[model samples]
Target: MNAKDPITVLPTDTAVSQRAARELLSSIEQAQRSFGVASVVLTGGTIGIQVLRDVRAFVENGFTEADFSKVEFWFGDERFVARASDERNEKQAREALLDHVGVPEDRIHAMGAAGEFETVEEAAEAYARELTAHAAADSTLPRFDVLLLGMGPDGHIASLFPGTGLIDAQGLTTAVRDSPKPPPERVSLTRSTISSAREVWLVVTGEGKADPVAAAFAGEPADVVPAGAVAGVESTRWFLDEAAHSKAAERGA
Candidate 1:
């Protein structure tokens, strides 16, 4: 896929849900055709969970389980305080999709559990080292085929909230502290690194997200709501349900 103008909106949540499923399947097909392997990054939140669940069902519904074996999974961002076994993004993913599916253990590289590292900084450094070591032999960075993300009501993604120091990071990952949201500690991929992905897909819903969704696509250039930094090397998509898109058309109108 190539970078294009913002996709204004989807008709409803059901439509958004169905499109997410098709998109993941298409990513799998494209990766298989292009690189012989497909790598996907996952996020956590309402729509995030919906996307995963939908994919799991899609795969179960004959999308081909064999394709999953060739897929590698990564996290877009992670909390620094919760154990991976806790009910967080990585945990939910393992329970909801990975564990239930056939993606190999080695192929699923999740962030460290809260207590795995002595400090968030250590955690961030460890993840960075992992990514750097896994970089393609010819390139220091690997272009993720697809990165599924969710927008915070305040416009955050991963742990890259607005006004956070991590926003300016040149590294792949960074330690965050005192996050405005609870469980203040977190590790997140920086904007520079995230922008390296081949495609960035945002699944946002609800009236609460309408303003920020409109703002980010409207070229507001604000960083506090980190989603405003919505850019990717190849493509960026806003897969918004009606609630999130309600204000979008008006913004254009």
Candidate 2:
């Protein structure tokens, strides 16, 4: 989808909550059939956690052999210092979804959060190298079937916050030295990298985020907002609950 298209707003969080799971599984199934493998890049936050939980529930309920064995997993961005085992996104995904799901261990490719390197820049380069290794020999970009993302009140996605230098980063990943958010250090995919995905699905919620959501979706000269730039190579969609969409409707109306 084009970055200028109108945003789709749902009636309630519960509605999106119920539909997102089926949609995610459906998308993965379709992608895997179309391609030999389906690679997914995950985002971190409340909506991220919700999506993970929903996917896990779907697997536990039924469809045991859902063909996720061919699905490869990766993270869009991650904190540099925090342990991957910490109660953050990676750990949360593990506890809520990945660990419970039947995805093969080799298929899951996450960031190195153990602080193996002394600096975030080194870690970012390492992740870029890792992505290069995983990509097809002819293409440096992995044709990610799905990139699950979340939006911050300030219109940040992954670790690319507003007014941050990382917004202009060119490679697949960049280390954030002083994030606007907590835990100052992080590694995030640049806009260039995120745009390589075949599809990007942003799951956002809460009334506090409504205003920024509206700005990111309806504002002109969208370049100022990082979230406004997350257009996938082929398709992109914003899935939002009612509370998170109040300002968007008002702006569009």
lDDT of candidate 1 over 160-192, digit per residue (tens): 887765567778898888889977888888888
- For residue 6, model 2's alpha carbon misses the true position, in angstroms, by 6.7
Clashing pairs in model 1? Answer: 162-224, 163-224
- Please report, as a residue range, the 10-residue window in candidate 2 with the lowest summed lDDT: 1-10
lDDT of 2 by residue, 1-253 (tens): 2545435667876667656777888888887778877789987787787777888888888853457778898899888765754645778788878877768998887776745887888888888988998886588867788898888888888998887656788878888888879888888888888888888888888998887787777653334567877787777888888899888778652
User: Candidate 2, 184: how far from true, in Å?
Assistant: 0.4
Segments in model 1 whose C-alpha atoms lie over 4 Å from true places: 1-3, 6-8, 64-66, 82-85
The lDDT for every candidate, in the order shown, is 0.79, 0.79
Q: TM-scores of the models, in the given order? A: 0.93, 0.92
TM-score of 1: 0.93
